[model samples]
Target: MSDSRVNLGKQHPAAYKALIALSAEVEEAAVTAGLDPLLVELLRMRTSQINGCAFCLRMHTRDALKKGENPDRIAVLPAWEETGCFSETDRAALRLTEAVTRVPDGHVPDTEYDAAAAVLTADQISAVAWPATVMNAFNRVAITSPYPVGG
Candidate 1:
């Protein structure tokens, strides 16, 4: 164990609380946007995967499976752009999630936003962006804190 490490969520209870609240709002937005719940989890999982957040990867992968996401899709998610396994809606959302998660790459290329806008309703586009934003925040929290994963 690193003696210098702190659980960011535990150490900053109010910030974590705010994130928890934002998470609920994000979920509500996703549900109201008519995104499939499995798609929601997949977004979270894929974002976590990009962030190298093992804890969230485990948590969201479990959530995805519980929501009846195809195990094959989960396995191939890292290569989503090349796979025909995902629906067009899934492809759009996944692309948006990846772009949002990797904002350091280009501050979210306009092409990415345009691709999502082309396929998703305005509300759904907003919905997808929020969760990806929130997940990126959570990924930073988890990765910086070096949160433990697995049993």
Candidate 2:
């Protein structure tokens, strides 16, 4: 066995392009549904964090910061529940993103769904899921392809 792998996106350009298109559509949907662009980036960061996708975590973290997200919020994101840094809507979106990313844990249990529904409108809920879903796919691509990360 050798330490070598194909870059999935390069090997399968069509599928990768489709995923990118889906990501664009999801971005539009999130904006139309009234999700703050920063919040959307946070959701992406959270999903990447959970999935251990360093590539995405770096990308979305920079995106969030460039959009004026607080550095403290990003630093405290993994322990969000223990902090008062997040708003109710931020908390709801984070929880929902966690559930979607960790679906294998309990299959997006009603508890998580209910928690999100409590703070999010129907469109907002749908909007949040799209990012998480798309991030998960991207994470898989990056992790399996093992996209290189560097300082």
Candidate 3:
């Protein structure tokens, strides 16, 4: 018999359930922290896109649309620095999103941190961090699991 391990979805039921539970907690924290849900979804989508996480990008793109994020902005997310589609708050959040997701290059620079902090309250910062952290975790899972992209 072959010795290859099965996929997580097929082999590890309990871990999958735990991930779902942790995701719920992250969502609750984002909401309770007074974050704009749409913005949180946008951040998730952007980070997922950067990480090439097809599962999360698909999931969060739908969630962002549901919360009334402009389709135009969603289309232009990869070029956020060049577009005027996002508000100052959104730009700040996006900067933080990039910093968090791309971190080992250097510490999150003070300029990005200060910009995000200026637009977002302490609670809002926490809220944004939750989604960033969650997306990063999900990215790793998808990457390692070699999850398929298209059916």
Estimated TM-score for each candidate: 0.95, 0.96, 0.86
lDDT of 3: 0.83
Number of the top lDDT candidate: 2
Clashes of each: 0, 0, 0
Which lDDT tens digits does candidate 1 get at residues 28-117?
999999998899999999999888899889999988888788999999999988888999899999999988888888888999989989
List residue ranges in candidate 2 displaced over 4 A: 1-3
- Which pairs of residues collide in model 1? none
Ranking by lDDT, best first? Answer: 2, 1, 3
Span of ten consecutive residues with least summed lDDT in model 2: 1-10
Off by over 4 Å in 3: 1-6
| Tens digits of lDDT, candidate 3, 1-151 | 1236356655777887777787788778878977677888889898999898888898888888888989999999999999998888888888998889888879688988998999988877777777788788878777667466675
Reference-based lDDT, residue 106, model 2:
82
For model 2, name the residue pairs that clash: none
Best by TM-score: 2
Q: Model 2: what TM-score? A: 0.96
CA-lDDT, candidates in order: 0.91, 0.94, 0.83
On lDDT, who's better, 2 or 3?
A: 2
Candidate 2 per-residue lDDT over residues 113-137, each given as its tens digit:
9999999999999999999999999
